[model samples]
Target: MSIPKYNEIMPNILRYLNTNGEQKFRDLEQPLAIEFGLSDAEIIQEYDSGNGTVFLDRISWALSYLTNSGLTERPRRGVYKNTELAQAFLDKPTEEIQIFVKQQMALRTAKQKAEKAEEGQLDESSDLLMENNQTPQEMLNTAHESIRQSTYDQIIDTVLSKTATEFEGLVVKLMERMGYGGQVKNAGTVTQASNDGGIDGIIREDVLGLGKIHIQAKRYAKSNTVGREEVQKFVGALAVAQSNKGVFITTSSYSAGATAYAESLNGTTNLVLINGEQLAKYMYDYSLGMQTKQHIEIKEMDSDFWDGMQNDSKVG
Candidate 1:
């Protein structure tokens, strides 16, 4: 069978529990997975909070739900056995799977209400742990992205207020890391004389060593957006370069008028814009002038060398 949905996994669980008689939660997972055509990877898709994919944590939740709904009973907190509902379902074979699942859900919903009435919220932090979870490195990267967005935004805002020389160095470092060293001509290399069309830096984009596209970087405040006039000037510069492509980047949001102006394609140049958020994300992903922090270690089992199996006679 194809990979089943969240609800569909339950009937298979009931079938397994009914046939197996009883099993520890940990023990049930593998067989349950195998019977349902799920590999270790896909078993976790059957929970309420499955991060858009399945995890062993979801399998745990499935077990908890089964226990709560009266289809399974926990002999101990961790041990599970088939309940009357599970037994009955096995006795009466149903071709209509949907009805059986609905019945199972109804029982669990009622059980949850009864439990809440009897005891206030018991700590469920343990319940949050997902099964076959992500490695620490993957999780660390996820957390880092969140941290860097806020941290970098603040840093970018602060850097924008600094002297032009400081800004120049920061831009150069970031740009160099982003693979634009040779392509970038001035790149804060030469200080613009006075106000030169508000164009801060110049970059040459060569596609596979063929054709060149010019780029202009603008760093501004959050409130500031590249207006039509600014875009017009950039377009004018592209015309001077006799180029059909240009990039206008800012450390702030873009105005709709400015965006429309670039999109007008006025039979001239194609101007691409990248705002603050996009810029920071690219920088973060590319690790552009950014330092890596504490690495998280993800644990795994070594099955190639099992912990030396005992002889059959030795156990007896």
Candidate 2:
């Protein structure tokens, strides 16, 4: 069965606390998983951002909502118990409980906002109560991923519109920015337009130019698939240049035959194939053809600091 949503988990949490007495947060997870009849895989399914498991995240938000609604209390850190008010909620249907919690949370938010405004310290921030099932962190991750994908699409489109020579120069610059060429001036160069021997660009791996990496750039549309013939031609170009390393970058995917051919020559020739998706990702990661519009930092409490204070009090 699919894991229950946060609101759906609320009633079960209340019932467990009421029956089981005070419990630590970690101790609640197993029993809750059993109650939901969730498979091991479902319980451990990670969010897209790889932050935490979806099941645990939902459980955490459920507990937070219950605490804010006065249905539960944390008497000690990481330890939760049901309050007398929880008894009233235990008998209610899950839908009614959800509605009550939402209303209580709304009231709490309004009170906090009013207090902040009175102090002339009100800033634009989202309310603590989330309307969707996702936790606050998950929401932020989704937004970040969406923005990145949009930027990648825009970059690919812009690159596609440029001339072939311009595209070759761009890839060479990208290689230099990616820590190739080792601080050498003009270490990467685009070849002349005609009679370039299939190699569009080249990067000297060191200042002395003892080692070199040949580049073949193909600015093909998404509909076009680079085949083994193109890869073979690049390999021939590498042979002509007396180099064993080459990068074949294209704004389109490669055929299975092309990928297999490259893999077959793994020991004899070193070849790196960068497709449209991978190319855009590399550009975004290296901050090429894109600029940062905003940056956000997420922070958590320093348990060590509080622990030190407690130890100091004991010594006192």
Candidate 3:
């Protein structure tokens, strides 16, 4: 049989956790597969992306959706247990699984709408789950993007709340987290110089401190915009520091002319301009000043298994 859709896996996941109390994610895959009478080939099936075994991915999403709906709680990473809602659902007759699933999905949708409303972004995209066109994978992707956008907004608000010096320190920390300086000892340094060059900080490219990347941070509000003159001064500071690369990060955006001027000198100097949105994205990506709230592991098909299966069939 084919691997079940993510929704179909939800009941099994809840039932397993409800019985087992608490379990690691990997421990549930084989038992659930056996319970479903899945064949060896089906058990090994993967998605097109080669991320992981398909059955496991479905189980992961089942757990994720359940958690989102407050039916389950992940006490720590890679662990899951039933909540009161899940236990109550399980306590009902087995025939009630379908009703429970629908109820949970409705709750999840309502919660999503409430979150979008709070973010002031309740729009058409937020209603995609209700639309008929999206596949299960598309639904999962949309949910993932929504979480990321929410994080991005939170990061922007957090940076906006910091002092100018504190913001500079955040940029330095982000650079260090991105592996700019090989060692944490002096991978990056913030220069609080009032009248020195326009540069705000410097990060080493390696542990030995061989090469350097210059940094300039602007803590401007979203309404303010960085202009051409700022970029020009940053370039001048690069010249003074004898550095070829510089990163100009701002909580605001850059004007078109500023971007054009920076692009005009792309070949002469490698300058990377990071605006508020991009800066927040990088911070989230590099895990700077952030913690792992939850994890959603996406699994895909394994082509090698099928290829080997075909080879074995031909040999037989």
Candidate 3, 165-215: lDDT as tens digits: 999888998988887777548788899768647988899887676688999
lDDT of 2: 0.88
Judging by TM-score, tell me the better candidate of 2 and 3: 2
Which is better, 1 or 2, measured by TM-score?
2
Superposition TM-score, candidate 3 onto the true structure: 0.56
Q: What is the lDDT of residue 15 in candidate 2?
A: 98
Preferred candidate (lDDT higher): 1 or 3: 3
Worst 10 residues of 3 by lDDT: 307-316
Q: Candidate 1 residues 1-316, lDDT tens each?
A: 5454334455666787777776766686677668667765565444222233443444555666566567778664356777776766664444344355455656555566668758875543333222133322334445666787786786567767877655545554565557764654443232373754444554444434344545566667777787888888888877776677666767787889988877788755777877877777767667764678766554544534443543343321
Pairs with backbone N, CA or C atoms under 3 Å apart (clashes), candidate 3: 46-301, 47-300, 47-301, 52-300
lDDT of each: 0.60, 0.88, 0.80
Error of 1 at 152 (Å): 3.0
Candidate 2 off by > 4 Å: 1-59, 85-132, 183-185, 311-316
Those runs of model 1 whose alpha carbons end farther than 4 Å from true positions after fitting are 1-145, 181-198, 204-213, 264-268, 302-316
Evaluate residue 195 in candidate 2 and report its C-alpha lDDT on the 0 to 100 scale. Answer: 82
Each model's backbone clash number: 6, 0, 4
How high is each candidate's TM-score?
0.53, 0.74, 0.56
